[model samples]
Every structure is written in C-alpha cells, then in structure tokens.
Target: MAVFSVIKLSELEGAKRIDAEYYDPEYLEVKQKLLKKKFVYFKNLVKEIIHPKEIKREYEEEKQDYLFLLAQNVRPLMFDLSEKKFISEEKAKLMPKNLLEKGDILFVRSGNVGDLTVYTGEPKKIIASSDLLIAKPTFKFSYYLGVFLTTNYGQKILIRGIYSGLQPHIAPSYIKTIPIPILPEEIIRRTEILYLKAQNLLKQSESLYSQAESLLLEELGLKDFKPRYKKTYTAKLSDTFSAYRIDAEYFQPVYEEILSTVSKKHRIEFLKKIFDFRRGIFISTDYYTEEKTSRPYIRIKELTGKTGIDESKIIYIKDNYPIDEANSLQENDIVIAIIGDTIGKTNRIYKELSGGFCSNNTGRLRIKKELNKEIIPEYAEILFQSVIIQSQIEKKKTQTGQPKISDKEIKSILIPILPLSTQQQIASLVQKSHETRKKAKELLEIAKKAIEIAIEKNEKEALDYISKSEEK
Candidate 1:
C-alpha cells in the first residue's frame, strides 16, 4: 500500500515551505487534531524565544565562580549539573541574558535537534551555551508545555521543521510557528503535579549521591585536601626507563598527591585483587541490522550515568546474530569506557540493562567471587568515579590518535579499601540514589504518556490513564 497526501495550493503558499517533510501527512493529522481542540501558536504562549549570545570565554576549573551549561548538560526533561564547566563572574557579566531562571524551557537548536529540558529552579545563577534556545513561558504551568514538546507527536513536528544540509538545524522562527494545544485545566494540573514530584525525587537522588561522596572524602581525610602544583619535580632516569617512555603529564604532581593521600588514609589494593576486567565483544559493521529484538547493543554514547540506559538510542542486531554469552552484561557489573574521550567514565549495570551486549570500546569490571565479601560493586563504582581512582586512570591512559587504557593498566589501578561497615553505608546511599532516579523517570514517563493520550484520544481518557498509572 502506498500512502498519499493531498495538499491545497493555498496551504503551500501559506507555509512557504516546499520540503515534503514540512507537510508530512502524519504531522498534518496531528495539527488537525490539535486545531480541533483549543490551540494557539507557540509564540503566543511564550513571552519570548531566543538564543544566547556567543561569549568569548575560557574555562576556570579551579576558581569556578559561575557555572555554564552546554548542550551535553541538557538531557530529556532533566538538567545534568554534573561535570559542568565554569567561568569567572567577571566573564559571565558580559552576557547577562544567558542566565537561566526557574520554569524556563530549553531546546537544542543545532547538532542534536529537538532535545528539550526545563530548568527546575536549581542553582540560582547559571548560564547556557549559545546552542540552546531559551523559551520563557508566560503560562503558570510550563511543565505541561515541556512534557508535550518531549512526546512522540511533538518531537515529529519539531523534527519535521528542521532544515538539513551541512548540519541539522531548527530556528526560533520555526519553533514559534509550531501549534500548542490548550489542554484541559485539570489535565495540566495533573501533569504539573507529576512533573514537580519528579523534580523533587531527582533532587533527592542528587542529595543522596552527594552524601555518599562526602562519606568517601571524609573517610579518606580528603574533605578539605587540595593538590598543590610545583614548578619543578625530580624523577630518576631509571624510574622513567622502568615506567617506559615518559610524558610530562604522566608525572603530574596532582596524580602523586591523589595517590599519596589515598595510601595515607587506607590500605590500597590493586583492582585485580577485587575485580577481574573483561573486554566487551566486537561485532563487525557488516553484521549490523535494524531488526528489533530484546537484545540492545550499547555503545559509549548510550553509557550516560545521568540518563541511565536509553533504550530508545540502542541499535539492535538481527535475531540470528551471534552473541557471546560471556560478554553479555549482568546485574551489578560496572561498565567503563576504556577508549577515547570517555575514558574512565563508568555506568553500573542495573536490573533493566542486564543481558544487553556491551560495545567493544568498553570494558566490564566483574567482582571476583572470592573477594566479593571484601568489596561491594556499588562502592567500587563510586570509587571509580571519585578523584582518587580517576586520576590514576588518567595517568595510565596511552594517547596515540585516540586515548586508550589497556586492560593491564586497568587491572593495575589502585583502589582504596574502606571498612566493610563503611562500604555498606556508602553502598546503601548510592543504591537509594539509583532507585530514586528510577522513580523520577517513571513519573516523567507518565506525564509524557498522559499528554500523548490527551492529544490522540480525549481529555477524559488521558485523565483516566494518569489515574490508573499513578495507582500502579
């Protein structure tokens, strides 16, 4: 069967867009349904939609007076404040309008178009990169608007408006023309409630992780410790020969400081003593397929800790594709990026991601059964993310064209050993953080589904779905 769409001459003239995607039948149907109910241009609902002015600035890592958010900081329906770059207050003053406030909606305009997130009133003063389009909604319930934009129907319309050539792009003018349905007040209220609840849960998750980090630092007596850099350092010729060819970065004072601090506070043990490193499977590109299956092939990009594992982004292989059972992920396994810019980044496998195929560029750290009683996987994961182990991993990384750490180097990385009781306390906090984040995601999905149901069916049906989902 062939699908056809008939468009009127006047409609084409009105849109001034000759691209077939701009007039896709599915988008037209969604538009018609929205128009059947109360609808208004997106520009009318928002006070203004604008992009930030480009700032000529440099990152001030040590003196981080002002925080800056890049496109990577904006995840779906959430803002990832971790690993943020900062600038001095003097530099931030140059562009005051870029400062974000509560209830403001952010949309990605370039590279990863159509990605959206709302600033949920955290970090009183922060600025966003120029790649983000900031929409300041005049309506009280902006969360409802944010939820709608992230849904399948909303994403399709936004994506269809994209102009692809050198790069995929969406302009503010195109975003202004998108239609927004004026949903029932009750439905909007329910969405706002759920959205706020999710935000609260996410905050709890952040706080729990912070508590766990604090415990680790306090235990190691590094709560107020700072690395001091010296202009000159001495290293013996024999030492350099034994460690192989030397780079100035490999002998940084900060690396030694981190190592010395950990050794002083706790008994240090090599990673091989507690966990065995296993490399992920490598499948040739010729074997790749679009066939949908229960198995997901996870790449480095999909290993984001903040978003967990995005099932939507995973590429599937054919059902008959050979899978190495030994390389398959298991619950509580720690997946680390052993190659490229993502080196040292880690994501602990949860129940939902078990049985997925890991990418070749990654490595898994499975707890040694004999030493499992001494080390907790959750605690080890947090340690890997901490400054102590990360600095060591950074020093050991070999940079050719792309940076990579060998499995031998990974096994040789030292880990600080804390008391089992202390490990349990930290593990419990981290586990709760993951659970809270899961709850936050569940609530956010309910809100998105409710908006979709309301648009495709009726307001009453959407409300019923929300009620039933909440019961579950």
Candidate 2:
C-alpha cells in the first residue's frame, strides 16, 4: 500500500522541507494537539547539552574500573548492563564530560534520532561513548521530559526534526526548535518520583545478580581467587616442543593457575561427556532487514548476559527460511558464542526469544539424557560465564586470524560439578534479578501512559489514571 501527503505552500516549514513524510497527517494532528495546551521549546528544559568526543581509553579489570558505556547501553527506559566494558580510573578522570550523572539524559543525536534514556544509576560512575548526546537536565525534569519524548506525539515531532541527507542526523540547533508540551507541576513531580523508584529497583536487580555469581564462586572455592599474570614466564624446552606449538601466548601461566585452583576444589568433567551440540546454520546477509516486523535473527553479539536479545542491535530475517532446516531455537536452549568478538559468551534462550533464528557462529548445548538429571540449563549458563570456563576458552581459542574456540577443544573443555542444592539456589537468585528489572521498566511505562492521557484528555483524568494504576 502506498501513502501520500499533500502540503500547502503557506503551511510549509521555514526550512522548506517538501519531503512527503514531513507532511505526514499524523504528525500534523499531533502538532495541533500539542499547541492546544501551553507548550515550550525542548531547549528550555535542559541545563546544557554535551556533544561527543573521541576519548583515548585504557581497559581494566572489573574490580579496578569505571564502566565504559556504548550507545547500545542506553536502552529506552533504562541502561542494560548485561554486557559491559570498562576503562581505567586515570583515563576516566581526564574526560569528565563523558561521564554520566544520575538524572542526566543520554540522547542519540544521529543514527537513531529521538531514542534516549535517563540515567537513574549512580552519579559520575558510567562514561558514555562518543555517539550519545548527554544532556544535564534541570531538577527532576529528566524523568518528565525523557518519558514525554518517547511518547507517540513526541516521537513524530522528532522524526520531523531529522535533517535529511546522505546520512540523516539531528543537531542540537534543530532540537532547540522542537516543542515540548507541559503538564501539571504535581504530575511532573510524581513522574520524577516514579523514576527514582525505578532506579532503586534496578539497583536491587543488579545486586541480586551479583549475589548469585558470588554464591557460585564461593561454593566452588574460587571466591577471593585472583590468578597470577606474570610479565615474563618460562616453560621447559620439552613443554614448548609440542606437535603444533611454537607460540608464546599459548603457554601463558595464568591458564595453569586457574586450572590448578579449580582442580583442587572439585573434579573437572569434560563437556563432551555431558552435552550434545546443535550448531546454527548459515544465512546470507541478503536475508537481513531493518523492518522489525519480520522474524529476528540472533547472532553472537545479540546475546545479552541476562539471557535475552539486545533489541536495539537485533536485525530481522526478511525472507522465508529453508523449510527443511531445524534452525529455530526453543525456550531455555543454552547457546554459546564459538567465534569472533563475543567468543566464549553463553546464555539460555528466554521465553520471549524462543522463535528467533540463531546465526552460524553460535552453537546450542543440550545436556545428554544421562546428565540432564544432574545439571540445570540456568546453572550451566552461569558456569560457562565464570572465569573457570572463560580462562580455558582463552587458552584454547585460535588467535592468529579469526579468534575462535575449536570443536576439538570444546569437547575437551572443563566443567565443575557443584552440589544440586547450590546450583538451584544460584539459579533462583538469577531469576529473581531478571524479574525485579522488569518491574522497574513497568513503573517507567506508567509515567509514559500518564503523559499520553494528560495530552489526549485532561490532567484531572490523567491524575485519576495514575491514582488507579497505583491502586492496582
């Protein structure tokens, strides 16, 4: 179906956009409704907008680090810390403008216009990447404005603000011209309160996940364990004269240190003894689409640590898949990244991700019938993510060309068998963590709906709506 819009010359924007989409009737309708109430320009709502910069960074370990946030970390209503990277404190201090404070809004100026999220986490802890437009809002305006812009009317106005060119981008100069509809002061105050509640819930969620990891490591006696990494380590001539080996990196002592620690605590079992493999099938890039209505294609990068897909980075399969292939992943299927940037990453398919198609670089692991009674999939994913398994992957994976874990090496990979009760306890905490995060998102949603109702109907009705939503 084709859609057309006719714009009158007198009604055209001063910048003179004749693009058919610029005159979208829906946008025109929203423009009228927004003007019906008292409105102010978006620029008047913020303190200052910080543009992106190219910052030189030095990566560091998790404990001695400040988080480095990429554009993908800025989710719609929250930041997804499932996958994380870090920078040294020395580098973090040098570029303070890049560091995000709580209540600051992280806006995407290009690529994904109108997409932004308020930071509800700790102040000055996370540093955003160069792709984000970090805006420090006045008072609690962050919560009110952030939710409002994501509303249906707000999104359309942002679309109209896009300066179309070879690569469409939104400029701060253009944003200054965007209108923001104002609601009651009390309504804004309540929205701010809701965001704070959401933030606290998210903090609780992260703490639960950490507790789960700590429990697993504690049970395995790897708690408070730090493997030594020497500047220069030596190996005997006989040890270096293996059939295929001349590489120095292959003989790193850190690998041995980790192995020795785990072996002393528990007997290690070869993964091949307990699991069967289901490798994903290859599909051409021609089948990929940005049209999200199509079936999503899950690659290794799409695997979030929370056992879910990163929808912002996810792509859809435009064409019908081959009829004979059993490429579809089912709920709770444990998947692992076997190649490229995310090699060694493992997660289970959540209920929402059941029907998604997996890419060739990823492989699914199913516990053999004999071993299924002993191991839980959730527990397996947690074990795979730990340094116990990751260290082995680092020692075995090819590093010369494309980084990968070989099939032969994977079969021989080590696994620790923990007590069944301990595994269930760890898995239960992880499930609770994921649930708490959802509740946080739900609160943000109530704010969004309230904003919509206030604009469409009246503030009295909207306040009643919030009151009723709270009662429920």
Candidate 3:
C-alpha cells in the first residue's frame, strides 16, 4: 500500500523542497491536525536560535576554565554530565553569543539529529559545541517547549524536515518553521509542574550518588586524598619482567598511589573471590534483526547506569537464535564493558532488564551464594563505578588499536572489603538513587503523554488523563 499527499503548486514553490519525504502523507496528517488547533510558528515562541562557531579541537584544554557542551553530552530527553571538557576564559570571551544560560534549550543540529534537552544542570557558565543549536525561550515556556518537542508529534515533524544523506542534518532554518500548538494555560501549567518535579528528582539522585561515593572514600581514608602525577617514576626490572609490561603509563605513580591507599586501609580481595564471572555469547551479525523477538539484545551502549534499560532502543534477534539461560541477564547481575573507550563501565541489571541477552563484548558478574554474607551485589556495583577500581581497570587495559580488558584482568582487580554494616549503608544510598531516578523518568513520561493526548484529543481529555494518572 502507498500513501499519497496532494500539495498545491504555490505551497511547493514556497517550501522549495521537492524531496518525497517532505510530502510524506503521515507527516502531512500530523501537520494538518496541529494546524487545526491554536498554534504559532516555532520561531515566534523563542527569543533567539543560534549555533556555536567552530572551535578547533586543539583549543580545548583539560583545565576547568569553562564547561563546553557537545552533541554527545545531550542524550535523548536528558543531559549527561558524566564527562567534562573545558576552554579558557579568554577564548570564551571571544565567543560571547555562544554562552548557555540556565533553562536554555540545547538542540543537536547534526549527528543524532533532533536530540534536545533543557540545560537544568549546574554551573552558571556553559557553552555549546559547534554542532549544537541553542534555543532561548521566554520565561517559563522552556520546559513546556522542551516537553512538546520530545513527544511523538513533535519528533515526527522535526524529523520530517531533516535532509538525509551520508549524515542526516536539520538546519536551524528548518527548526524555525516548525508549528507549535498553543496549548491551554492549564495544560501548560500541569506539564511544567511535572517537568519541574522530574528535574528536582534528578538533582536528588545525583546528591545521593555523591553521598555514596563520599562514604566509600571516607571509609578508605581517601576523602581528602589526591594522587600526585609525576613526570618520571622508577620500577624494578624484575617487576617489569614479571608483569610482562614496559609501558610508561603502566608505571604511572597515580595508579600505585590509589592501590597503596586501598591496601593500607582494608584487606583487599580479587573480584573472582566474591563472584562467579562469565562472558556473553558471540552471536554473528547475521542473526540480528529489528523485528520483535523473544529477547532484547543488550549492547555496550545500552549499559546505562541507574537510568535502567531503555526498552525503545533495544533491538531484537530472531526467535530461533538458540538463546539459553546462561546467556540471558538476571536481576542483580552486573554487566561490565570489556572493550572500547567505555572499558570498565558497569551497570547493574535491574528487574526490568531480566531475561535480556547480553552482547559478546561484555562480562557478567553474579555474586557467589556463600560470599553474600561478606559482599553484597549492590555494594560491589558502586565500588566498580568508583575511581579506585576504575583506575586499576585502566592500568590493566591493553592499548592496541582499541582499548580492551580481558575478563581475567577484570577478575584480578582488587576490591576492598568493607564491613557488612558499611556495605549496607552504601547499598541503601545507591538503591535510593535508583528509585529517585526511576520516579523522574516516570514524570517525564507523563509529561510527554499529556502533550500527545492534548494534541490528539482535547485539553479537557488530557487534563482528565493526568488527573486519573496522578490519582493512581
């Protein structure tokens, strides 16, 4: 079956877009419905839309002079502040217009096109990378517009304007022409309230994780410690020969500093002692499929910590791919990235991801029943994410074309054994963090759904839906 749309010659001339995608029937239907309701052009709703001037990669410095926001920093519907890059104040002064203000909408103009999020994170001074488009809306309308753009209706229209090629791109000019429905004041207020609540929860989640990390460092007497990086270090020839490594980075004083600190604080044990480890099965690409199947194939990118698994991003394999219980994920299992730049990145398998299939490039750690009394899975996960174990993992990584750490190397990394009471305390904080994040995600979903309802039905119906959802 084929879908067709009839466009007037004058309209076609005005658009100047002869591509078939521009006239897609589904896109036209959505546009017509939105136009039927009270609406205004997207450009009118914003104070300004601007993209950053290209800054040479060499200009970026490690010093925390000013924060730079890149396309990769903006994930779908959320801001990832895990990685930080900086530029000098002198350079930032040269580009005054690129500065990001709180609540400014950061939109990606290229690669992972249409990925947008509100800049609700900390630090007053932030700048956008060249590939991002900054949309500064007036007053409280930022949250409302952000939620609207993330909805299915908004995504369809925004994506429709994209020009596909080697790399799909959405020009700022296209974004300016998008139609935004002028929803009722009550609906906008409700949406803003939900969005604000979600943002607050996200902040609480960050605070709780910070507390957990602080507790771990405090327990190890490393709360105020900083590793000294030396230009040169000496090591015994016999030690190098025994380890079969001669790389300078392998002998970095910081690695030794971290290890020595942990060794002096508490008794250290290899990860293998507390858990049984296994690698995921290697299924060839031929077996992968986008169609629905029995299980979701978990990849390294899907190992998002605490945010839980994103069901929408999960791709499927053929039902007859011969999956077995051994290859499937289980609750409380820890999946660690064993290859690429994210080597050592770990995420605990939650109930929602149970029974999913893991990719071959990952390793799974399950607590040994007998060792449960000494170490809990949740506490171990927190330890894995901490800088102490991460430094060790970095030391053991092979620096071939792509970095990788063997499962054996991962199992050999030392884990400090804390008292059961302390473990429980840290584990409790991590669990609370996960819960708060989950609630935040739920509120975002409600906000998105409410917009969809308002557009598809009416304001009254959407308000009723929100009321019923809150009551439940």
**Candidate that would win on lDDT:** 1
Give the clash total for candidate 3.
Answer: 0
TM-score of 1: 0.90
Residues 348-390 of candidate 2 have per-residue lDDT tens digits of 7777766667788988777888887798877887888888888
TM-scores of all predicted structures: 0.90, 0.80, 0.88
Worst 10 residues of 1 by lDDT: 304-313
The lDDT of each candidate is: 0.83, 0.78, 0.82
lDDT of 1 at 150: 83
Winner by TM-score: 1
The better-scoring model by lDDT among 1 and 3 is 1
Sorted by TM-score, highest first, which candidate order results? 1, 3, 2
Segments of candidate 1 deviating more than 4 angstroms: 1-37, 63-65, 163-168, 282-293, 310-312
